[model samples]
Target: MLEHGAAPPSSEPPTAPDPVPSPGFVGRLARRKPVELLVAESGRGEGGAALRRTLTMWQLTTISIGATLGTGIFVVLGEATPLAGPAVAVSFVLAGLTALFSALSYAELAGSIPVSGSSYSYAYATMGELVAWICGWCLVLEYGISVAAVAVGWGEYLDELLHGTFGVTLPGAVSAPLGEGGYVNLPALAVIVLAMVFLMGGAKESARINTAMVAIKIMTLLLFCGIGFFGIQAGNYAPLAPLGAGGVSAAAATLFFSYIGFDAASTAGEEARNPQRDLPRAIMLSLLIVTVLYCVVALVAVGAMPWRDFAGTDAALARIMEDVTGLGLWSVVLAAGAVVAIASVVFAVLYGQTRILFAMSRDGLVPPVFAKVNERTGTPRANTVLVAAFCGLLAATVPLGELANATSIGTLFAFALVNVAVVLLRYTRPGMNRTFRVRFFPLTPLLGFGFCLWMMASLPAVTWAVFSAWMAAGLALYFLYGVRHSRLAVAVAVAGRD
Candidate 1:
């Protein structure tokens, strides 16, 4: 028997580590987060839970396609066609080329970086905190406003569906936004609410629903092309480029909104099962598929209808289907499909915005509440609810054209930063492992950056004004709050003190 006094002593349990300290104000803006650390933190949150990696490569591609295909072909085609005449097909091509260059850059960085912040995370790793914050702010404008813009477009198709199926349409007072002949847009608000409910469930569930909706959208557009081909007249093609080259450039800038979602998969990096390999494939594949479909549909649509007739047209695709087949049944079919299509856009884009905010919050740039993940659902529920409320209000009041242009400028700016980030990362981290790399090294990324600037310059002056105001607000917030709270800055300070 052992003596009681001779028993071995136990070790004291380790105490929890101290919370990171905040940094000083000056020069904190230029601090860069290490890429290795960012990668390590992928699915984790400062709020104490991990994001579930439930998305496969297939689901990722669907999210990208779902976010993109409908916004242009169903809703905004009418708006763009009148600006470029029959040569609107050329606008689609031009926009596709811009997207392609950017897509390659995105592919490399997504494979290398693989975080929920997308370009914002890339900039943080390669550039500095201030540039990354600017990129993230631009993303807020891009994804958030596009959701509202798409919701407003969805309301247009809902009106068409109502009239076709039941011979009743919502009155302007309830269906149109304020200052656009209506007091508020209830239908737009409804769609946002519906998407929010699905999002609250989980990302995997949403992706399943989106994939189904994307299939319906594609088949519907193809059906329209089949029937509308008979309505084409060669005379409709005569006045190509009625507004000339300047007009084409403008139309391309507007149409860039159509390609906005091709990068949606990049935002899902943390939620992807194998982000390094899958993210690059998902982005490039989705962009290629969408670009082909967009060009085909735009060519078919303009061939079937006169460009001038596109002006002031709501539910233009359904109107074209009805005219082509001389039956309400086809219009009903197209309208129903559009309802599904535009809803998917709202769903995917809203998901992207929430993820971006979650990333920022974890970095201590925004409030920690945004980084909080629900224990059961593996989602930032509060973030989703708050973003939905904001986007819903915007949908209920803002006009669609204004929302769309504002979105395009913000997207172009963020994309340009992403291109720059790629070149910078290559120079600094030459030995870092990369699953995907841009073909021409500096040339590819440089061209991508140039194309982004070209498109931004082509947007109207009013859009630039809106963008400048938004950037000013973002910078002010970053300096006042982000500077004081940044985790990287805090780490630097802690290291210095040690």
Candidate 2:
């Protein structure tokens, strides 16, 4: 509908990019994209490619659940249980509580903003362009690495399921990364490509597929509980607090990764049929469901055997199933469930990562080609392809151990910023139409920020170093390209002249 670079019908006309006339580098970088403009541009959809409204609260909730219930709960128990002993359930609760506070803040913002780009857009509106760029950059790392990591994990589980369920063998020397005893990890690449196919199919279709997969994952866990609960020895719980308060909190910090994906719900803000009401509900519903599932799994895993034996487990749930039921069949089922769950994670997170890039591209903060949506599919196929290809390459090359834990630190920083944006918006634009506001007003956001900071502090110094390097690289890129081409920056420059 646009001819010769005119703005979309409903949005403001972008300033013509003739030259970097008045405002030089520092002036341009200091410029802020007004909150009103962000709100106006968002309703026009990513830049101007209005996303199709397809997801209901149920579909949105499943995306969150499917993303959260991946390899974390399946494999992290071994690492966390040793630190918290039988009190690992308490650790799940603690992590869930921290994530819960952030989810509430996210609910408030998503309902109010109802836009894509997640916290990145929110920060741009409430904070400034620089902060937004950094936050978006952190998200890029968070999601890109996460998708690759999940794909790699999915490959391992797929190998297990194939060999166990059928009489097949995936030669690790051929199917895994060179550092991980394989040449290229074909299954990981395959899954990332399949995710691209699913995502390109459109949001509604992907949501339906994700819903079915999440159900399978949940049912598998339920089967584990139904069988494993019978083998519970209450005696194993007596010395539950053997690791003490410090240890339990430390374990809680580690367990925080398990609850990471509930925010993937917010990524669907623009796609939600009723963003104001549904976004908030989906966030709360998904968090509560995942929390309870995690706690129950922790309790069952600890109750079925000695907590000491949980350390160094490869696939915690599968091993627990075998050890508790003494049945190879149960173990195989759990392994298949893990494979399905991790695949869902890769799908949803990959979907989220692309949408984030699409949002950024619309603002001209990145290559504008990424913002182009496929008119036929009503999806951003180009962005999805770019993200999927890069993630696929990373998955095909990087070993799991080589993938840094910096993703979590990046996530925690973003959550903290989301909470800040919420507080600032509350004071700055108190009358904004927020269908779902956080309860307890300022208290909830403060707690959310505090919780995120505490967990971020718990990460290792090396993780912080890696995170800093990533942020620096992001700033460097922003200065080199983002500042000059940003639609908002051009608009601001024009406004100053006027």
Candidate 3:
């Protein structure tokens, strides 16, 4: 459940308004307070006390990589290419830039807060309870739906691998759960269940699995790029921006979904070693690596096949390779690799959703049970089970395209909020310490917000309607339950007695 409420009003009304502070001063103020909060929180011995700082920089980098480079690259390119032609490459760069701006803002907050729940926690401590609740609500959509959608895509790729490798085909009903032929997606459900078991084992084990999967996926993509580069044709570059600037921008907006995983790194701040230094490095490094890979993959994919042919195809990459290489054997290998890649993505994302819920529960923003860690496993067992069940249902029932638009829209909203929070925190608290600060202060964060809004506007009208309804439900929950239950509210009451 989500929590919500307005911050309590001051005991006395102000006689005069304070002057608006300069952006730089505001930035410094915002930067310092979160660090103080984190230090205080760390000393207090809360939940996650048993969790060790076991994640190395390499492991952290891979977690970011594994989380970000999943179905979006394999699935979205086919849809985006038709929108922008070869200029889809340009769209990738544009989306990367938008993400980079927001990523910097996140680094600053993660450094200061060093807490979980990513932007949700940052908003609570800096912006006020109401805004924090909204941010957390937006994140629920971003993390939860993304896991479902990606898991469903994973199921499709798994089926592709089976058909390609074994020459044995499962019936449509058995292969696809609630798909066009009305069969339930058993593979997706199975994958989610398996991932849940691993996640319940604790952070160290999960990080190890993520690191290995990231390596495998990265190698597979590099192999594809290496092979496809040979097949590149100059003619593919003709009519580069076939749909013009509008189409390119639309594609860029969609591509923003591919960049969603970088912030997952920030969500692990409490578990990070020297979070103030490592979190920023991890976020920026992961973004840089993925941006380069995305560009290469888009270039190779377009050069190998006609952009028009990719639209609406689920197995777009394998088809392109098959046609280009005329080697069924190589396509089989590629399909198998994609299945592993997408599965890893689903695992990483679902883990992130569970963790975010855990953080909220600890703050009394949601049900307390959500924060309960399994003593033996050191994992948030209750939250993991709940999240996995919901994600599994969606993966089995919903169509991928139906959910993709909503996922992108939700994420853009969260990203925009995070950027704005960075600016707000800067103005609200100035004396705090910060290990990392976003460059150019207000200007960078402002541009990041503007870009996210522009992308949000590009979503279809139906997506907007769905987002509005979800937000309304969240607001209702906040007012009905969360505001009354919040720890911050209780703290205020105690202070009044003193």
Candidate 4:
């Protein structure tokens, strides 16, 4: 029966390879995946492996706190307070409420969906691929440009810190970008590298660092309040509304930058230990903490000094502390605190960008390579490096103000879209399990959308032009590649035939 040790064959047949599906016209373009599918997709690491869920509520909250509490405070107060006068405190409260509306909507979506990509994923789950693309594109601007902007701000504060403490400074040859009078922004680029290294260690370690930094930021504000309160002249607040209601509105819009990262907590939904319960709680808690801190600081700042005096000054809080106590040392320490706060913002924002890109990559909207997570680090190493490189280049090249306006517009646009997604999802998937439903439903989401739109409309025309160009470019890319190769497009094509 057998010659030369040959054995008898089994009665099994060889398997055929799987076929690649085609893309259908209308259906493929508008394809929407179920939320459950997205939930599963969010957890898959490199090559569809699983990611470690290690972030707790505290970590998530700190992520929001760390990102929201930024150098914007150190800068915006000096600039915005002059416009709103002592009523800048009220402006801070109003601005915070605007973020709160969207924050509530975000809390609901993040809890229910528990995916990355923030509003982009929310739009995909609720709206369609096209809207989701727009949201994702805007997020690329929001997260990417904001990092560069914050880095520039950080660079300035770093200069202030070094000059104040060490009596030394970085030379312009290494500190400024081309158009701004320097070869490159060394400090900004260096900070990006530092953040990249920390993130490479993975999310848990970053959280630990962020928590400590957030604490310092809050404590520094507390110290300012504790000292500045004793100097409150009460008379300083006599003309609280000197700039009138218009001024309050204007200042509120300006102050929105300080409240930018409430939704940052939701971006980490996948890594959150309790996505539903903790994500919502963290979002709300961060908003509450930041709002309280801003209001108290604004009140104390204006009360300690005439609101007019705050205008046109750098390190306003530190200067105020010096004015209150006549101690040059406290001013330096406060300036140093500002440097720390802005660095946390950079870290948190960069963290948010990588996760969003990871989500987009998982959907086949971008290169799948970005979806690859390091098995050892439990992080997306390639994606993190790419983001760092992109941001570092921008930080080293672009000036701060040019980078800042576009971010606010992009952020507000995404917030409005997210608010819309929540409303639409409530109607589309009534039966979907929601761990945290927005309290007032339609009223809240609609108002959130309106508020975001109002602020967006208030931004400069050049900002809109830049954003429009970016979106147009995104549309071109989507049509050229995103449509033909999208996983959902393939699914729709296969399902239609079936």
Question: Who wins the TM-score comparison?
Answer: 4
Against the true structure, candidate 1 reaches a TM-score of 0.89
Per-residue lDDT of model 4, residues 47-128, tens digit only: 8555678999999999999888987777789889888999998999999888989988888888888887789999887777
Off by over 4 Å in 3: 1-39, 42-49, 398-404
TM-score of each: 0.89, 0.92, 0.88, 0.93
Determine which window of 10 residues in candidate 4 has minimal summed lDDT: 1-10
- Which ten contiguous residues of candidate 1 have the minimum total lDDT? 1-10
Query: Which 10 residues in a row give candidate 3 its minimum summed lDDT?
Result: 1-10
Better of 1 and 3 by TM-score: 1
For candidate 1, lDDT tens digit of each residue in 1-498? Answer: 001111123232333223232355435666788887888788887567888899999999999998888857776787898899999889988988888889888888898889999999999887788999999999999998888888988898899789988999899999998789999999999999999999888888888988999999989888988888888888999778999998887888778767888999999999999998898899988988888888777788888889899998856777778888888788789889889989989988999999999999999999998898887888888989999999999999877575567888898898999999989887876766678878767888899899888878777898888889889999999988988898887777777789
RMSD of each: 9.5, 6.1, 7.2, 10.3
| Cα lDDT of model 2 by residue, 282-380, tens digit | 888999999999899889989987899888886777777777767788778988899899999999899889878878988999998788877766788
Residue 475 Cα positional deviation in candidate 2, in Å, after optimal superposition:
1.0
Residue pairs clashing, model 1: none
Candidate 2 residue pairs that clash: none
lDDT of each: 0.85, 0.83, 0.76, 0.85
lDDT of 3 at 15: 36
Question: Ranking under TM-score, best-scoring first?
Answer: 4, 2, 1, 3
Cand. 2 TM to true fold: 0.92
lDDT of 2: 0.83
lDDT of 3 by residue, 351-435 (tens): 7788677777766768977877666766777788999999888778767664555777878888888898889777765444566
